[model samples]
Structures are given as C-alpha cells and as structure tokens.
Target: MTQNKAAPQNSVETYTIYATSNKYNRPPPPSTVALHGMDLIGAPIDIRNHRFFHPPPSHLMSTTTDLIDKLKSSLAEALELYPPVAGIVEVNEKGEFYIAMNAENRLGTPFLVEIKDTPYVGDSETLSPRLDMLLPPSSSALAVKLTQFSCGT
Candidate 1:
C-alpha cells in the first residue's frame, strides 16, 4: 500500500469559503425515536475523524464556483435518499436519548465550499491542518466541507 504524503505548504496560497449550502429539496418527515450502540459505546462522545482525498483529474478541470454549485445541488438530491442524516438527536422528557429525525434542522448541515488558491501541482496532499478548521463547531451532528484547489480539485 502507498501512503500519500502531505503536499508542500509552499504551493498552497490560502483557503477561503466562497459559498455555503444549507438547503434540502424536501423537509424530512418526523422519524421514530432511536438510539445507536456506537453513540453509547464510549463516554457519549460523537467526534470521529474519517478523511480521504481524490486528486483532480489531470485532463478536465472546473472552476471553484462551478464546483461549489454542483456540490450544493448534489447534497440537496442526496438528502432525499438519506433523510436521517438531515435530522437531529435529542433526549425525551423521560431522560432517554433518541434521534428526533425531524427534518427541522436549524441549518441542514453547515455545508461549506472553500477554495484553495495554489499553483497547478499534479500531486495532492492529505490531512491538511485547515481541514479541521473547515468543519463547523462540534455541536452539530453533521458537517461538510468541499474544498476546490487551484487545479480545480
């Protein structure tokens, strides 16, 4: 297996958010109360790191604005299939924790589209320090960030 090394910081000029998408095509219906074993496994913490990256195709490239638009549109469509992801978790009056599944998310997902201005370097980097900052505060259950590098990645 090949380990991907971090890209040289010299190539990356800066990272900035150009747009935000918090829209869902259709509101999610009220869902039944439920609990997850994983949610209970630890000391009731829910922060986990699962990161991956795909380098931009060498041939075709899209602008940052266009990439953000496409991502926003795709997220709206995806919510239709996975409604729960758009819901929230809460504990009932009885003091038992459960997921509300109600489509009533204050902000569906703090979806952020960021742009990284850099020279067109063929290779890519993983585990960027800025990646952590891109995520919203840990209060929300779901958060997403789509970063488009200068190479239209």
Candidate 2:
C-alpha cells in the first residue's frame, strides 16, 4: 500500500475498492427476495460483525498486494456461492424490504483496506470514533474490511 504524502503520520488512512464474483461463473437469476417474518424481526436494528486477524509470517505474505489479492479472490469465490450477499436491499411498493439483484448488472461488495501507523491494541469497550467511516452504507447487504497495522498484526 502506498502512503499518502499529505496525510498526517498518526492519522488513519483507508483505501476503498470493490470485489465481484468471477465473470465466468453463472450469475444469479434476476429476482427480488422478500424479507420473511423472521428477517423482518430485526429490520429496524443495524448490526455488524467485525473480525480481526493477526498478520501472517513475512514469508507467506511479504507484501500488501498479496494480502489484498487473496482477500478479494476469496470474497469473489464466496459471492459466487451466495449471490444474495452482493444484492442491494430495497423497499417494495407495499413498504416491504427485500433484496434485489440483476443478472446483467451485479453490484459488487465493498472492500476496505485500512492502514494504521500504530500497532493494534485489543478491542476496547468503547466504540471507535471512526466507526461510521469503517462501515458500508445501510443499503448494502455485505461488506469486508481489512485493517493492517504498522506492527503487522
């Protein structure tokens, strides 16, 4: 990852990109999947799952490109199996929420790579100040973020 020359040394920086399934893979049928009763139970609540991983050995992943490539590839393959994850959440005419996807125009998942100048400490009880920036828009069905610390953890 290239550093931004204008950014402050201690400020957090992020690179945003999109990842899509392989073009050769069969696309999902163009359809609208309505949210059932169980799905509607938590419709008003927003929840996110955050995961962190320790850096691999230098020999395995020596550069940031390798890490980003692997992640994008993996996510693409996963999308092939679960196409709904790449869909957008939309409201129907009757005020019902559903996932919508088009075979001809696939909406890829949002992928973010955050570079931190400092080493990562354990998760704190308090929410992060940049939490809003780290998450995808509410309309998106899925997203992924990879945070790389200067200390490689």
Best by lDDT: 2
Candidate 2 lDDT by residue in tens digits, 1-153? 986665325433334333354565675445777778688673254445566778777899998779888888877777766767777777766988777766533556667676766677776522232445333433456656676667676
List the candidates' TM-scores in order.
Answer: 0.55, 0.71
lDDT of 1 by residue, 23-88 (tens): 544443557447766665655443445443555454553644555556666766665556556555
Report the number of backbone clashes for model 1: 0
Position 10, candidate 1: lDDT: 32
lDDT of each: 0.50, 0.63
**What are the clash counts of all predictions, listed in order?**
0, 0
Candidate 2 runs further than 4 Å off: 1-27, 103-105, 125-138
lDDT of 2 at 11: 39
Query: In candidate 1, residue 152 scores what lDDT?
Result: 40
What value does the lDDT take at residue 53 in candidate 2? 75
